[model samples]
Target: MNYNREDELKFRFNQFIISKVTGENKDYYSKLTIEDFVDIKNTLSNINNIITYKTTISFMDWLRDHFSYVDENYEVYLKDVLKVKPSVNGYDIMVTGKVNIVAEIKCNKPINNGFKYGSAQKNGIIKDIQGLLEGKTKVNFNPIHAYKFLVMYDFGEHSLKATEHLIKNIPSGYRGKVEIYNDKTQLKIDKVYVVFIK
Candidate 1:
């Protein structure tokens, strides 16, 4: 999509008003006044390559390294840090390239659940990105810049199959590449749409 700087600035202004009137600090720009925040959003709107495959992959690795395992978790997944503050929260990975791509991660079982919620989380992350893009938040997160949700499931052959599926399904609009982590190797599987979306 072609990003218009002026339109984004106007939208951010409106967003600021809404936050002030409704008393919602949820806008990423709630920390800054409308007048002061417009420039930040406009600057980011111009950044098109902020989200990239290498950067996103690096961010995911960082995410895995930053947080520690905890007792409050499930057999399949464990969230050491449920949220990241300041810029974004509730996302699996957050990275800054020329711009930024915030990704959320989810997993599912191939047979029983069939990666249902995992997909939902991806959608939720997209919705969140959309909201930020539309200036619904005081500060625009530039969801349109480039973003993705990871739905990872299965650990063995199924994982490979799922990765294959992901290679096929990733939308063309996604700016970055989709990667799959196998036993000890990480492959840049850009063609398939079915890696275990976790």
Candidate 2:
């Protein structure tokens, strides 16, 4: 059969939305908006590296699709576009050829029924932090700019808690250099940051 992934994704999104929105008055519709629905829908597709936003999800798309209110101060970096696709060229998103404005995207469900991140999940997140701080690519990373995002697909409260917990174990060496948010952190132009999306 000739398969069209975009059509399939749209079907899945519609089904998911229908299941979610069918129950009752949208006033209490999971307390989320239409944009939230689309974000979550695309997030699943993007994580799977499907049509719209792939694992190789680009700066253009990320900027256009997601909004970060990770902190009030982070307003400066919010939605600004980079001319090139940094993450596509490398493993994850980077604002420049150097280590300015890096990002790690995670589309994981909070493990063990949303209580927290499992051991493997924690380790994977740590690895992303590691790669962001120290680029795994052939080129050496020297963070010359600000902001590093650990973008988590908002999978409800459990996922939020899990993300907060992940920040606690940032391997000390990176503890000083980077500014990651559990609840909040002082925004800096010289440090990588974190943002959550769904």
Candidate 3:
């Protein structure tokens, strides 16, 4: 899709206004006149590029903070570390316990840019599921069962539809099941989670 810088700025500005007007500092910003708000929004739009980077970083930080507690009630292993092996790619976070779960966290800027459903991204997820089904992916801990998950920062309908298409198009020989967890409020971020289980 073509990128419109002005439209992007306006969207970011609206997000900023919503956040501030509904946040702890709402009293201060909400009291400002519409003209003052527009002025502030314009000033912010001028530095939207720089603020964009900051917003991305902040989103990632928020993800880390929330996902860190995924296994709060369980005895988690490899909580904050990445596990790598010579055979398969590394995982961002591995939660090993009664129900072993390997998670790959992905942060995409703007959240609205959506995910690309090309071979690279689609095959990457497929390959991970394939590896898990074939016992090619390795983890430090052992459990009776395990699952693979791709946790990405995306809420756009296009991205979600693309993921659904990817799941439906998986080769028939694949034995595992792919499921999406769309209501993981614990994460507290706009995210789409795809899971594969054997």
Question: Which one is best on lDDT?
Answer: 2
**lDDT, residue 121, model 1:** 42
Better of 1 and 2 by TM-score: 2
Q: Which candidate is the best by TM-score?
A: 2
Q: For candidate 3, lDDT tens digit of each residue in 109-173? A: 32235544666666666765554444443444432254555654454665567767776788776
What TM-score does structure 2 among the candidates reach? Answer: 0.52
Model 1 ranges off by over 4 Å: 1-90, 96-101, 112-139, 143-154, 169-198
Report the C-alpha lDDT of model 2 over 49-68, residue by residue, as the tens digit.
44213332443345434333
Count clashes in each candidate, considering only residues at least 3 apart in sequence or on different chains.
27, 3, 0
Tell me how far the alpha carbon of residue 149 in candidate 3 is from the true structure, in angstroms, after superposition: 1.8
lDDT of 1 by residue, 137-174 (tens): 55434444533335343355655554456445645654
Candidate 1 lDDT trough over 10 residues, lowest sum: 70-79
Query: How close to the true structure is residue 11 of candidate 3, measured as C-alpha lDDT?
Result: 65
Q: What do the candidate models score in CA lDDT, each in turn?
A: 0.43, 0.57, 0.50
Roughly what TM-score does model 3 have, to 2 decimal places?
0.45
The TM-scores, one per candidate, come to 0.31, 0.52, 0.45
**Poorest 10 consecutive residues of model 2 by lDDT?**
66-75
